[model samples]
Target chain A: MDEINLQRQSSTNDELVLIEEFFAQLTKPKNLDSIRDKAREFCQRNSHLKIALVTSGGTTIPIELNTVRFVDNFSAGTRGSASTEYLLKTEQYAVIFLFRHKSLEPFWRHFSSDELFSHLDVNPETNQVTVCPSFQPKLKEVISEQKKSENRLLKITFTTLSEYLFTLRELTMVLNELGSKAMLYLAAAVSDFYIPPENLAIHKIQSSEPLRLHFELVPKVLRPLVKFWVPDAFVISFKLETDENILLLKARNALKRYGHKLVIANELNTRKHKVTLVTEIDSESIQINSQNDEIEIEQLIVANVVERHNQFIHDQSSR
Target chain B: MDEINLQRQSSTNDELVLIEEFFAQLTKPKNLDSIRDKAREFCQRNSHLKIALVTSGGTTIPIELNTVRFVDNFSAGTRGSASTEYLLKTEQYAVIFLFRHKSLEPFWRHFSSDELFSHLDVNPETNQVTVCPSFQPKLKEVISEQKKSENRLLKITFTTLSEYLFTLRELTMVLNELGSKAMLYLAAAVSDFYIPPENLAIHKIQSSEPLRLHFELVPKVLRPLVKFWVPDAFVISFKLETDENILLLKARNALKRYGHKLVIANELNTRKHKVTLVTEIDSESIQINSQNDEIEIEQLIVANVVERHNQFIHDQSSR
Candidate 1:
């Protein structure tokens, strides 16, 4: 099929059939009920506080049932982890960090993905390895903050796209009672295409021949998430584009279709340096500067998001 | 085309044209000449030492030029890292580890992939973080061993399949003079198919539509390595299978076709527990037992391979 025809087919199929098929075919994540129970308890315990579910990293979609190979998005979980740190710094919200397995985490993102051996001073004479003195202050800060928020933060990991979708749905259902008090900072780079369960190869794909893979567009889950699952929650999504020309338009389209509160739009090259916050009413650009290098752009993003959430809560109470 | 036709086409095209096309189209890895120079220097300095080039982890194949998504093989570098330890235990060879980026390394593979925070003892009041005492001995051993081998082990990392092929060819040529003294342990899980340079999408593959990807079979590089690059090197390849029934047959076929010294055949479920050493004449099944629970299976695998290499060296001298 032509590219235009294929796009039309996918967008049309996305409306209802795709989402319904996805849920119907998807096997629930293992131990999901117990996780839901725990989330329920967490919500009940922290009724007075706002809870934010921040998703990070890239999800995988296995082409084989006994997956020796899979497709993956390019993400390091920098944005989500950074935002979580900023949110915690405010001390205003409890976080449920649903992240891709082995991706970066809050406070830990400062370190490079090398062996911890490099950060330690190994004294052969004494047979002791200790954290280097230069890194001590940051380590102390991270540990102290972590210890203080031990009960407030929950981390859940998923490697596959299917597991991520299932876990997300279950978490939202458990936190339904929190209503507008909850926020979804959707920063994960989720896979857009996946082989259907029935189509997945039973064995590792053999290397003896040419390969042709057919993938159906993953039915967009945002519609149900916004309309049905915790409908009153202040939801924020992300739009990552390489082209500057289509960035704002795509972000606006997503906000209109999903009926979410905000869309954080970023070009691939400038994502770390600048981002535009496209809300229903207006767009605001946030950028890093020479003075604010120590304080990341995420600090600004979180501040604006928190302010909007506060306004949203106020409007609900007034009504 | 039919499946049979596709297989035939791929196998026929793999002879010479594919390899030429791949090299011509591939962007040379940055600093490859410097790396080759270093390898030559290493060989000259350690001329008396038996050198083994051990490949580890998984290689990626980008679908687009600006890759937002890519296909990847499933490997954590466990086998390669574990084998490296065994090879070092013999105290006979210098190692050049060509590995996938962020995958495991020797000695450090003992630690889990989670944040190192869990392994630390954090004193919130004192504002200090220290490595937990119980894990001290292993950490010391790893660090000391690493320090001792600082000059012996050379690590080169690759993320993409094209880079891997380029690096491998260069390394093999540099080590060509070592002849039967050199061993090539091929353990890395490589992607079987890739979108050729001419066909790759310029931008990220948009998810707005059902996506059908066409991949050409990656040309087999083993033939050139065996016959042309380092013809007299003691070569061993791995055959990882999910099915037990066909494992031995596939391993035997690879040995026959490539004229390699050995093929280490393994079933995915039992790879860590058992492996079959398929040689030119016979297949030997090696299994782990309770008596040797403290020792890894790789120690045994490496021992057998080392014995064979010794015999080969002896045979070469006699001739």
Candidate 2:
């Protein structure tokens, strides 16, 4: 048993070295400083509230340096955005939302293009445009809620895998100042493989030839994120899978490997309606009631997460 | 020369067979019938006006059967959507817009999320939502143009390469009834390669393994599109390249091989401000003047195209 533990530790050290090399090769995002400044300002203004870093959407992997082509993961950012809205409603937490550019956002998700366009009325004579009567009440409520939370919410957008990882590291290091008061809610579907920059084509690939692509495994950064970046912060990672049988197993393995506080496991088909919260000792499933369709599963998931987080803070204080 | 001609004809026949097989293996989009119906209605209502089928945006290549990952070509549909708006302004043309889902659309392209959100005002007392005074004029103009052109424009959306090709074929066959009065503006950034259904994974690809992808060249349907489907229609294809030296060469090659009327060539870096219209006899470069910053280059390109299309129609009628 001791020998096995020693071998695992050595492997983790090698992985950490690879992760460091990955960052060294990547060009840091230009807006990273702005993101850090916004986070610092939020922390200073809402000193009494716990800070939650919520990551949403999927990171893209560019196939070439010029990047006329890219591999994109499927995510509309529904879970992360909805969770942020619910967490903000608790009033105990302020959120820094790191999301993919142009993905669904917190209050804005309610108004899709079709819904918004259909509900708009234009008066040609007066040159006036008005939101239709039926949509006004809902629009008013969302706008008011959005205005109220404006001070507490900080949004930072990223597109590529390198941008997402670099921003994640930068934001977490800044939030580490809060110690146990900070929470990391990582929900972005990050790429697991990427074509190294050295191997990427600099020009648009011609269509006359057959194409072959080779991708190396992307170095796992979650291990360093939990163990080094914010050791004192409560971390909750999400695992999404198309296969239900391996879902909980993978979630448990992630928690055991990373030593994070919790793992939320969801399957692709039933993700909106059901999820399992897995920890070191046991797992609990959270499902929305089929009879009441009005409630979002994120609302229930956020409530449960807040309760557990409160208990964690209490235990830490006592210790 | 006769032998070479025979060899080229045989290869094209083989390619047409492959294209037919490619479509057979794919599942048809559920909304295809509605798209067909919409095209029929537009044609019936606007019999007096010349018809144009304008394709925009980029098509995606799914990496798996269930499609959690896809390789996407880069296009914001700027040229296509802008061209559609200009074509409608002529009042001589009714357009059937076939575009990628969620890409920029005609008129709506002017209002991005930030622009729309910042220009909105909510009245607290009456729960009234109104467009701000500063934005009302532009909003009113766009809304009124949108309403006026509703009857003349038919909008159809597609996502994957399969959907785009299928819809393109269906719409062209329907528009063929108009003969020389119809124009085909093929502007979409379509995929050059794809993974056939037989080679695709059944579920989400696991991250634990190194990914190796093999792609076959997508069969060129342009040959059959011109020779068989709507052979009498005026066809204009686009060639986009990163290398400037090869741009005009490739554009001319496309016209010679496909026997199309024109090829619009543009480099990736200079696409927005400049483009070259390549025909069998000559090539002309249309550039936006530095002095005039207000006019879109699409307006100039559309004017040139309309003039050529009118000449072609006049020639056919005289024949």
Candidate 3:
């Protein structure tokens, strides 16, 4: 009975309703065609390389159409960006990074805007500034690697939940043409509830009275995404919960329902320190502790994922 | 009867209750005492100069104690930041900027992270990057001016509404010692509603079910601030409304209720384009459009405000 209910929930018409409403509300992102063209050209040029579609940061749900206020999930794009750096180090894949506006990004994520300034010294005489000596090694590595992969990496930003969903679907469809050569990492903290276009207030919400906000469940885009859009590609989804007891259960359920390749489960507080990788065959907890804390956990997570990805490619080619 | 009711509301036990509750919930900011000491030192060393306390950006109200999600107002700190730059250019006043973390800051706000990178080139042979020639003149001017005023400027950041209120009260108490020489610019778009500490969930709110959030009204800190904290100092508050018709009315009401020196009235859509400066004696609309669009409205607003501040000081001294 439980399985039947879960199956029913996955196939519900609610998803179709959501997709329709979402499309109706979208204002076709201005650079959509240009981004699509660039991605196609990059893929064609780097045909021998494995390609990654990494979605980072959190998507926001505007409380009002004019958006004086918003409902925001807590994601700084640390995991996705750090993982991208690790993936790039392997030199095996071209990356298409779809991220939330103002969130962290690859390489640059390691330094804040203030820190960037502190690492440069103004030459008062020449009226110019250059990178300070101590930081030269790291900055040089980043610049060189970035130059090498400039043609292979594309970054696009989305702010609202609707924009993210539309872009995600479009990007996945384009990448699907590559078959098993494509990999999708859905790391963005997407909102579970949203005020549909028809229900959203047209102006900034008034604060004169007690504000009562009503949110509807966002349609499960993962269903259509896994079953139809990019069925051949390896997909990984994230499951974040505050309660430890329910974390694994929710993650397993998501894996079973969505039929995705893996689910990364984590507790909100300890997310940076630990994460559990759940797959059909096994569940593994990855941790960064006092001794190994010097190393970022994403480095380990990405290495393990790359190994599995290589295995997947070999198996597909052999078959 | 209306005046009596307004007075009663201002001194209602509700405000006291809210203050007590707010303090009880606050975790002393890590650098509170150090920041206070620095401000005191700055004030003493620069006793001859005027000092402005500018609060910018928007404060967040976390939905859960663990805070995986939050309710946030959309303010990029443009007005406060731009105004600060203008005030600094006068070289007459020292500034203490209390702003939302990661929001735009005074001089640096003018450049985006991407733009900063675009203005630099990395030499492969030397493995060092330098600012491109075209951008050097502007960068030099900004750097020199910033260096000249570094000692007179202090910046502190706050993220949560509780932190902002606590810091505001603490800073105001310190500044009150300066008496008529101090000015307060409350430009932050603080949250009107928040999930109080006692009512907040200990964990991230579960999204499996429909989310129903309950929020309590945030006490009007401006009342106690103007009435007791810094009664002798010039206080300017902002009134932002979506409806243009209500904008000036709300600003006037606020001025009467709080007895603040001035109120800046603005409609949401036209906030950047125009604003009405409201005072007890008069109101005036300041705008930048077809002819003066090249000029930032903050420049004009800051100039007018500085002129009034000068007149206020002269008037007080004569009395």
For model 3, which pairs clash? Answer: none
Report per-candidate DockQ. 0.55, 0.72, 0.56
Candidate 2 lDDT, tens digit per residue, A1-319?
5999999999878877878888988767888888788788889998999999999999999997878899998899999999999999888999999999988889888887657766777864665888888898888888788878878998889999999999999998888998888988999988889998889998899999889999988877888998888988989999988889889989988988899999999988889899999999999999987667799999998998888888888888899
TM-score ranking of the models = 2, 3, 1
Q: Give residue B287's error in model 1 in angstroms.
A: 1.4
What local distance difference test score does each model get? 0.85, 0.89, 0.83
Q: Which parts of model 1 have CA positions greater than 4 angstroms off? A: A1-18, A113-115, A289-293, B1-18, B113-115, B122-128, B289-293
DockQ of 2: 0.72
B170 Cα displacement, candidate 2 (Å): 1.1
DockQ of 1: 0.55
State in Å the error of residue B62, model 2: 1.2
Candidate 2: regions farther than 4 A off: A1-16, A289-292, B1-15, B289-292
Regarding lDDT, does 1 or 2 come out ahead? 2
DockQ of 3: 0.56
